[model samples]
Target: MTGRKALSRALDLSLWKGALTTAGSREAADAVTERAVPNEPTVRLTAVRRLYEVSTRMGAGRSLAETLQAVVDGVVTGLGFGIAVLNLRHPDGKFEVIAVAGSPEAREALLGTVSAADIFDGEFKIADEWGRLRFVPHERLPEGEVVGWVPDVPVSADPSAWHPLDALFAPLHSPDGELVGMLSVDLPEDQRRPGPIHRELLEIFATQAGLAIDKARLTDQLLAEKVRLEASETTFRLVFEGAGNGMATLAFDGPEAGRVLRVNDAFCRITGYPHDRLIGSRLLDYLTDGDAGRTRRELQELATGTGPYRFERTFRRADGQDIWLGGTAVIVAQGKDQPRILLIQIDDVTARKDAERELQHHAAHDPLTGLANRRLLQHRFEAALQRSRQRGRRGVLLFSDLNHFKQVNDRYGHEAGDNALREIADRLLTAVRHGDTVARLGGDEFVILAEEIDGTDLDALIRRVEESIGRPLAGIDVPVTASIGTAVVSPYSADLDELLRTADQAMYEAKHRDR
Candidate 1:
């Protein structure tokens, strides 16, 4: 072999022996160590072997800190370096000593370099052949940068003098093969600089170290996620058990439609069903037939994406009492195997519904006669006009006034007068069709809004009204007559006010003609 080739061969063999010592025995380590140069081969071999061993223990190391410490231990011990530091780039854009291995003095010196100011914004070069180690002083590094421990002066040398130490660095990469930080080893002033073998050994060690560290980081993230999932389960359980409002989950498309999957305690309390009784039961079983049927249709429509999730339904409680329930449903899944689960929330609204019904009754009906009042008459009048314009349906308005009814109140008491008015309201109701509206517009003035009528039906309607109102006043033993005037509501855009005015005018003319 040529001289250069022989030397390179020797170097390769030496490294192999160092790597092979663990791969083999002590004789293998000495086989390469005795060649031409003196080196800590056993040390580099141990570090490389340490890297291999540590790399194997990846699944056990659950934190990056533990993994980095293992790497630095291999670095300082395997290379006989004065100091070893594992500096990692943090999220805050700073490099800090996350792990260190060295003598007490060396470790303290390396730790002194750790501060908020130690940002990893520096530059250096790695030779392509000896591609791992880069030695640089603090001054050559970026601002606020610190690397390597202070060099130890020899005891035989000058005591007052201090010597500078240089850092030997290797890149630590992430799982994605991106350089995330550096693994730095250094020597005291009396120790020699790192040579080719030192650089090569460190480079190899770093490759494995980076893999171990990144794997450990990923393991830590997984562990953290597991902890979060357990905590979330606990919190959700607490909320579901202690909530005040009724809540339940329903399964769609089961043999028992809307079968209750799960129900909170509040839901059981609201529905007056025990936990065991509710679980296997259908939700519609507890609701009125009409409302339950409507809800089932709406839920089917909901699956077709054609309805709102929120609706009002009346439920039949366990005691057969009815209660209004405001409810909302949300589908949580899709597909047949995983039938859509509905999360339902319910609130009792029976009292509110009752109050609303009472208010509507008072607004639409007269207190004395229980007939529709003038306000309701106006509403129906406007609605009839709209229906006539839209559907080509005809209507009739019979304006009837009680003639000389004031004399009954003048002679008899007002109580008897009220009785007379009530009797007239009864007669009016009996005369009109079931769909018609007979409204008292104060005093003895009453109007009938008969819908779905035509010119042919008007005469029959007028006859019914005139015959009913002309009956005797039973309490007073006297006859009461009424002037019943009619106006036809054509299936055209007829104004309500104009029609009422014409009917009123015709009523007065009828009164004069009757007198």
Candidate 2:
């Protein structure tokens, strides 16, 4: 061997000795030191010191990038490799050349370079396994299967001589055996294939470096997660405060479940409540008096994960006015160990609810007389019949037709006729029992449904209603009187048409008698 080769071999032996001393037993180190370079204690100490220094820097509280860079630098300077490259695996399953320790030209050429994961898999699969180190001989490379950078060195006829195309790699793995990165080295100072001692030295250094890299990576991940959580919190705060509708976050477990944890400004405005009164208050506490219990049950169901609940509820305001709100509630699970929460979004719908009620009333009432129309009367009659049947009670229907009502409309026109009809409606309503249903079947025709009555009571009610109807109009001298008929409902009364027909026939007979 040439002097340069001899010196390189001596240095390689020294590194092996030092690695054994630091990583394992001093007795093993002594055994190796005595077999090779027995008098080169100074060289072995230098290698041991260099390895310690590199390991310290790698384990320092530095960034992942910085640690990885230190790993590659240590491989080159401490392990006597002319070039070292650390290729880190990314989430996308590709390997990126992150840190390079070599000539400036090689660093510029290889740093930031990316390789498909398939390439690494192929190389590792075919390469000779030198313990943990992978050695890919130049002859083993497949055609057109480009790997990474190759130094400009000519191949030698000697079988062990280093070639430009030969590749050596040490894969760094996490504690859980996941491959995190790979370290590539080339151009050993001896200009020959690495010996077993050289490979062992690389493995020892890689094991320690992998742990340091993994630690740095974990720290980086934790910091990134923290930043993301903070940003998410800020975004949520902005949206909750800026929303036009009421929004609330409520606790979802334990005794405090369904109580307000956070509420937006719109919630305070809608409830006429201040921030202090709303926070930590149970959602059911604001429900209108009659609905509080039912709402509480519904909220309890939501807390048990039976939601999302979409509903309309009446809530009592701070000043005791009830207002309608349309809302949705959904459970938001924070984390596996954290308590879940409920997110409620609500819109004030009092105006809409009032308008709906008004529409319903108009649909079932006579527009002209403000009395129950035929639709409402039919519904009430059915209910009343059901009650009478269930309780075995007697019910009565009184049908009345105004005498000479058409003449009054002809003389005074429709406006005065409407006023007269309204007056008549008022009088009839006043004359009947509070529970009786007064309905206008059509023009000049009215019916009263008086439930739970007897023959004597019916006679008294009919006479009272006739007297009210016989009174003269306020603004007109035209006289109007009612020709009345009655139908008594037994417990078995089931046909509404039959009852109405019987009353109609009696009404006609009474009219004839009056004429």
Find the candidate with the highest TM-score and give its number.
Answer: 2
lDDT by residue for model 1 (1-515), tens:
01100101111122232343553655553343345233444433444454334333422345777667767766655555545677775666556667766554334534424444233223344222234445554334345533332232221132322123234567676534456667766552223445444554465456556655655665552112211101121111111333334667677666755888677777888878888998888888887789888988888877766212566788888887888887556454332243456667666768889999989988998988999987888898888888888888778888888877888888887899899999889988898888899998888888899987876688888888888878887677556778877777867636767777888999999989877
Q: Write the residue-wise lDDT of candidate 2 on 84-186 in tens digits.
A: 7788888787888788775665566666867777656766777898766788887886677444343433345668867667778888876445678888887
Model 1's alpha-carbon lDDT is 0.61
lDDT of 2 at 216: 75
> What's the lDDT of the predicted structure labeled candidate 2?
0.71
RMSD of each: 23.7, 22.2
* lDDT of every predicted structure (CA atoms): 0.61, 0.71
